[model samples]
Target chain A: MNWVWLHKWGSPKWFYALSGRYLPWLTITSVVLLTVGIVWGLFFAPPDYQQGNSFRIIYIHVPAAILAQSIYVMLAVAGAVGLIWKIKLADIALRQAAPIGVWMTVIALMTGSIWGKPTWGAYWVWDARLTSMLILLFLYLGVIALGQAITNRDNSARACAVLSLVGVVNIPIIKYSVEWWNTLHQSASFSFTQKPAMPTQMWFPLLLTVIGFYCYFGAMLFMRMRLEVLQRENGSQWSTTEIDRLIGEHK
Target chain B: MLFRQPSELVNPLAFFTLVGSLFPLALGTQPDFLRASAPGLLWVSALLAVLLSLEGLFRSDFDDGSLEQWIVSPNSLAILSLAKVSANWICTGLSLVVLAPVLALMLGLPGYCLPALMLSLLLGTPILSLIGAIGAALTVGLRRGGVLLALLILPLYVPVLILGCGAVEASLQGLPITAHILWLACLTVLAITLTPFAIGASLSISVTE
Candidate 1:
């Protein structure tokens, strides 16, 4: 049992230390990758034979879309772990993930709409993929709302976790929506399971951006989680010293 | 103070469930757009039913002091919240599933699509319950929470509505309904697995506040 406690998954103190160390690397890597990917994608990749310059939006759109789903799953996993183990850190992670996930969803929607105007000849369609993505945005909003609505930190964390877990359904809907129904949105051009839909140059920078965005996500999540941990643990002995030190440093 | 007598609500749900199913029938042969919009209309009304039923989910327990007992019970607050949400769904969402075919007919949904419609509703309504529970749990003790609940819940309802309507529409168009059902069923499974945990957490939080 002591050994198991050594590996305790829910320990806030351990997570705080670990995330503090990890934040710098995530920030640096995300910045480098995003810069390289964006530049290479915008300038180097060949324009689409069909959509011309407008196809460039895929660089932003795909990564954001993928991140949106990934973060939701992360939120669900954190929520589940929090519930099952009564882990305080997991709840913090769950809350930290929501706003980032929501931002990713918003970016995806905006880029999709921007991409849509040129490619699909309209800004909006009742298309399954578009609609499902919109719903994905809503799910994120619900989780965020639930988080804010709750007053108690721990209870809010738990509620938010549940919202994340339940809302996981929207992830698959967003993923397969383009395929399940005949719609205005095109099928995925990039996949590991099947041949890449676009040429190498296009997929390469996009992949880089995806990796960069992930690092960025990690950095942001850790930063937020750190702040949440500090807020929630304020009156605790460890945080009291930390908070005093932070305050002194700020002065 | 706000609640009707316990006896009052005992059969109100059943009575309202019947009235709920009768609403579309009363609107017969009127607006062409509404008739054409059958799938959306029934879906909206069904959503409204879920919303209406949600008001009583935590309210009654809250009003009667049972909620305080549940909070302090040996059972975890999360578990109690899950039980309440599932019970609420059984009373409300299950009723929608049972009433779907009749309502489908009234909404002028095609005869052939009735089976598919009912099946989708069976799978989908639970999700509505689960998702709606998040909103209900959040606003459980808030005053005049209907609009807030609507704002919080309506957006979440879109995917279920889309897939539900999609399945029936597919059946009407004679396309393969399997894929649509598969998607909605997938959604249901996801909701079943995830929502209770969420609503439970939300319920606890609301109570604490």
Candidate 2:
């Protein structure tokens, strides 16, 4: 396959222009998808026979949980690319993704806990998924903290890359161990999976919401990457000219 | 070679002893409580002792500019990194394994579980050193990386900690400790196979910065 497109995306100037064009589409589509999915999930989807309305939280919980895990995967994959190619844009993507991943993990935990309150009769049970997510949050915090602690930007990015990659290697092990530890302590919950044993009405909106979350992440990622490109390339001729063009358009 | 001298070994060993001894006083001399908690207590203490000494893992080398020298050496950095990790395990990890039973005994750990505790420590501590060395390498260039290093690595340490203490706990409960021990062994093997490259890469970034 011809590789011009790959190298073009790797370049900050091209990426900045392409992402700017996509940003408006990303923002409008994600916002619409999220609103429609949430509305469908909350009002139209049938409630659980056992859980009643509290199970509605799955709309938010599963998407955030999936996003949280996938974001970590993205961080590691991007970091590996950055390290291998010495791609500044990939490094920026890696650095930019950490805090968002942490927040998504936080949302998952919060919603999981709240849902637990009504369903499990307690807010927390040290459940396997929750515990695993907690550890992931810590891992994200570690990446973010390492970045902040180091003074040099390039060093910090590479360091964070190496650190997150290490964390990525351990991610599966952590999930497995936490899950094993959980089973040792308690019986398993009815986890939501792609082929979950639920009615179509119950699971359909969840599918929509999951897709919506991916769109949301894509939108946010491109927006942040654009800002990162401008900041890192502030003095470059292309970025300066682009900034002037934007200023002229606004004026 | 910095840790070859007896004095260098003594510092962490002494600190290890002091940490292990203080637990009984802080928690009181209740034998049942001590026995029940001994595995976790000793494991946590060992984990901390290893972490405490990790500061020295690359600090001296970085300060004296030897880290850069190693970075530019003709040989593979991953192997060199593994060599340092092996040295660290021998000095800190092996010492902790040796000291664990004494601490176990001090904590009134049951007689039957001593072998289990030793085996757990033997399998677990090396994984700690291997992974911990990655954090140490990442932070070696920073002026204040001690606590930051801990924050970065402790979450990753959870699996090994669980398995190590779980082995002893299983043995004490008259259950099969074999599975837990096996898990620890597998993790150590995985760490051995992979962590050196990670440490070497991080160290290259650190020293080159």
Model 2: what TM-score?
Answer: 0.95
Please give the TM-score of chain B in predicted model 1: 0.82
Candidate 1, position A171, lDDT: 57
Best lDDT goes to which candidate?
Answer: 2
In DockQ terms, which candidate is top? 2
Mind giving the per-residue lDDT tens digits that candidate 2 earns over A1-251?
89997788999999998888888887787788789778988998887887788889888988998899999999999889988889999999998888889999999999988988877878888777778889999999999999999888899899989998999999999888888776422332224543567787777777778888888898889988888899899999999998899899999
The 0-to-1 C-alpha lDDT of every candidate, in the order given, reads: 0.76, 0.88
DockQ of 1: 0.36
DockQ-based CAPRI category assigned to the predicted complex of candidate 1: acceptable
Clashing pairs in 1: A159-B202, A162-B198, A189-A197
lDDT of 2 by residue, B13-75 (tens): 788889888888999988999889988888898899888878779998899998888988998
Off by over 4 Å in 2: A184-194, A249-251, B2-7
Write candidate 1's Cα lDDT for B74-147 as tens digits.
98766777677676676667767777677667656768888887888788888888788877887787767677
